[model samples]
Target: MAFDYDDNNIFAKILRGEIPNNTVAENDVALAFRDIAPKAPVHVLVIPKGKYVSFDDFSANASDAEIAGFSRLCAEVCAKEGVGLDAGNAGFRAITNAGPDGVQEVPHYHLHIMGGRMMGPMVLLRD
Candidate 1:
């Protein structure tokens, strides 16, 4: 199936200012905000202003500058939330769930910055 961007998605609305978000950081290419349902002590969502359905879509369509700026902003959010490498902890995890199997809830692409505590393994092995 072909992938298309849905402007009505919550993240898109947030990017368009149609919805309110607790913004943590922003740049010309992307915006970072605290997650409404946080999975960790420091949980932030970083999304690109451009239209992209998944991480692969964004990586394929977005410009190098946009990608770089978005990455920098994610790092900045981690640091600002005290979950960066300098934080005397186990560091943070950046995740992007792609497609249905990955359990991506929103159609728009986004990265989840989760930290501020020792995170468990990303997945459990099935025996």
Candidate 2:
């Protein structure tokens, strides 16, 4: 069964500090933690600290601060992981799964920063 992106979700509880997380980075607007089910070497899930049911929900409810923080957080993670170097910093990708059609299993919105080793071609889940 699909899970609702509501207060009861595990991520929501993590955000609320009701549960522990392997947080890699955190700012006022968002939190970055290692994905329990990692897809890559440096897989981190960046989730807004505030209430955001999904990508659309976050996009709609997020203020300028939140948006800027989210973008900055992505950059911060990339730099911290050294995913951008000439000798090669390797490569990186930021992913945000949208609605149900996008295969977003989680209800809460999050940015997936995946990189470290060479990654394969992008597979756009939606056209």
Alpha-carbon lDDT, every model: 0.89, 0.82
TM-score of each: 0.93, 0.85
Model 1 accuracy (lDDT, Cα): 0.89
lDDT by residue for model 2 (10-122), tens: 88889888989998888999999999999999999999887786777777889989989987887887788777454367678888887766778778888899988777878
Q: What TM-score would you give candidate 1 relative to the actual structure?
A: 0.93
Off by over 4 Å in 2: 1-5, 85-88, 124-127
Give the winner by TM-score: 1
Best by lDDT: 1
lDDT at 68, model 1: 98
Residue pairs in collision within model 1: none
* Residue-by-residue lDDT tens digits, candidate 1, 1-127: 5457887999988988899999999999999999998999999999999998899999998999999999899888978988888666569999998888788889999999998888899887777
